[model samples]
Target: MSDSDLIKLYSKQILALATEIPHLGTLEDAEGEAKARSPLCGSTVTVGLALADGKVSRFAQNVKACALGQASAAVLGKVVIGLDRTTLQQGRDALHAMLTKNGPVPSAPFDGYEVLLPARDFKNRHASILLPFDATLNAIDAS
Candidate 1:
């Protein structure tokens, strides 16, 4: 597909996943949490997660970002539920690979992350797209 076509398609898919915005920018009933902000755009995302048996039992976020950031958070919210630690880590890895190098497409489950491929070209927006996942990983490590 053309670049514009890719961007338009992914943007719509990403936006469709974001069903609700957290009022306080935080998760509910979370056992682990972290927050991140982008200095470039003043966008912020806070992720909350609950872990049980080394799997995520709950995942949610409160985000205040541009369309890119909001869409990223929405996509994350949709896909991250029910993921194990290993799967979550893989998702993070896939996201980093997609952002830094032209690598293999993300595998199933996280394959939805490919929607973010078009975002790589917009370097300044990288942090916005990554903010939710970054905070989530931080929360995992902090737990």
Candidate 2:
């Protein structure tokens, strides 16, 4: 990619989000845990969580990835509290579509994901960007 393309993909907002990723550690009593990796970029994310009332009661993650992935994780961490699997799944799917199919931004709560729109053209970054969501979904199932 060109320097301008890289600049567009890794905007100040995305880089700032990367530095502010929340829930940075694992839960000691986590009921579920899962990890996802992007073979192309070697980016990885591990998620640990607990569910209560069919909603995410606790969430944490270890993200070792590109700025895009870290930004994605930060967005998820910002709104993961109190959300159910269905909503999380919808957000994940919507995010995937937005990146791959030019679909609309994910609805409320997940609207923070709109910052990632510039990444749509970088198909190689898509998997790493989705790692946090994939790991979280798997962790939920493991719970």
Candidate 3:
């Protein structure tokens, strides 16, 4: 990647988001918990959650990843409190398509993911970027 590409991928907004990750710890009584790692970058995220009325009732995460991954987690952290499994799955699918197939940004609540659009060209970073969503979804399943 060129300097210009790096600049685009790590814009001030992305960097700001990266530093503001929320729910940054584990939950002792969580109903589900899961972790995802990006082999290409060795980035990882762990998610712990509890569900009520078939929706996420509580959530937390430990994000140890690149700026791209952190930004993704920041977005998810800000919006995941009330989502259900289907919504999280769709967000993951949409984010995947956006990165790999030039698809649209994920829908609202998750739309904050648009900050990661520039990452579409960085295949190796895709896994890390998707870590939060993957871990959360897996955590839901593990519940």
Candidate 4:
């Protein structure tokens, strides 16, 4: 495969998501907050959330990473609202499998993770791709 093919991993769709981050701010009154960094690439993601009725009521993030990390943040932002810990954990597990174990895409709500399939072949990108979900879980645990 050519270098162009490797570069193509960041498709237009993924770039769109990356550049147009959805929940792209901080929640001052967040109940929990956590940040994750990829030591290999120096990519970072900080997530904050407030829970209501045991589900996500508000969510926000600051992402400093590549297009793949930004896209993952966008996908997480889109579906995080109203989600519970169980649902989030399932998504995280599925995402891990998809990237490392050749498993299917994450289930609904997180099914959008399919947009990241091309990234699976690039192991170096895996930690950045997983940052949003990991930060979210860390925040949840901290709360």
Candidate 5:
């Protein structure tokens, strides 16, 4: 697709993803939790995680952000629900690679993350897209 077409398509996908935001659980009985805020944009995310046998048993989030941040949280909510710690870390690494290193397009299961590919072109939005995952990783590390 042309650059403009790609941008339009990603914008539509981002908006569609945003609609899933309301489905994200805002609370969890987690072993640990972490909150992150972007003072530049006032976007904030709180990640709550439960651990069982050294694995992630539950994960949820509370987020107050713009469309980009909300959509990223929604995407995270879906894929992160059942992941183990290693996989979760891998996902975070994959996302970082996609966002910062022009890595390969995320494969199936995580193909939904492809919708965020456009975010790379817009640097200011990077933090918004990464915020939820960052908080989740922080929480997981602390757990």
Candidate 6:
């Protein structure tokens, strides 16, 4: 890929999202917790959750990833509270499709994922882009 294409992977929107990271610390009393690592880039994300009524009551993550991964976590942080398993799964699936299959933007509450579309062209960055969702899924499943 050209330098410009690689540069595009860290678009302004992506960087802005990355800077807006939420739930920045781990929850001390989390009911579920999980971690995911991208061996290709040494990016890591650990998600912690507190669930109630089968929905997320609180969420937190420790993200050590590139701009794309941070952006993905930022998007999730915005809507994770009150979300159910099905919705979280849909977000993960939609994000996967967006990156790997050129699919439509992730549905409502997750439309923030659209900011990551430019990352699709940079194949090597795909794993980092996916770390948030994978770690989240593991966290939720553990709950």
Best by lDDT: 2
Mind giving the per-residue lDDT tens digits that candidate 1 earns over 31-132? 898889999999999878888887777777788887778877766776776777677678778877887787666787767667677777677877888887
The residue pairs in collision within model 4 are: none
In candidate 1, how many Å is residue 132 off? 1.6
Candidates 1 and 2, the one with greater TM-score? 2
Model 1 collision count? 1
Candidate 1 regions exceeding 4 Å error are 1-10, 15-25
RMSD of each predicted structure: 3.7, 0.6, 0.7, 1.2, 3.2, 1.1
lDDT of 4 by residue, 49-79 (tens): 9999989898999999999999999999988
lDDT of 5 at 88: 64
lDDT of 3 at 8: 97
The stretch of ten residues in a row with the least summed lDDT in candidate 4 is: 1-10
Please give, for residues 45-83, the per-residue lDDT of candidate 2 as tens digits. Answer: 999999999899999999999999999999999999899
lDDT (C-alpha, whole model) for all candidates: 0.74, 0.96, 0.94, 0.92, 0.78, 0.89
Q: Tens-digit lDDT track for model 3 on 51-126?
A: 9998999999999999999999999999999899999999899999999999999889889998888999899999
Better candidate number, 2 or 3, judged by TM-score: 2
lDDT of 6 by residue, 93-132 (tens): 8888988899999989999888888887777888988888
TM for every model, in the order presented, reads 0.79, 0.98, 0.97, 0.95, 0.83, 0.95
Worst 10 residues of 5 by lDDT: 21-30
The top-ranked prediction according to TM-score is: 2
Which regions of candidate 4 fall more than 4 Å away from where they truly are? none
Clashing pairs for model 1 are: 25-62
Q: TM-score of the candidate numbered 4? A: 0.95
Residue range 1-143, candidate 5, lDDT tens digits: 48895566468779888888733565546788899887678899998888777766677788888888988888878777656677767777787789899986566546678888877766677787788878888888878
Question: Which is better, 4 or 5, measured by lDDT?
Answer: 4
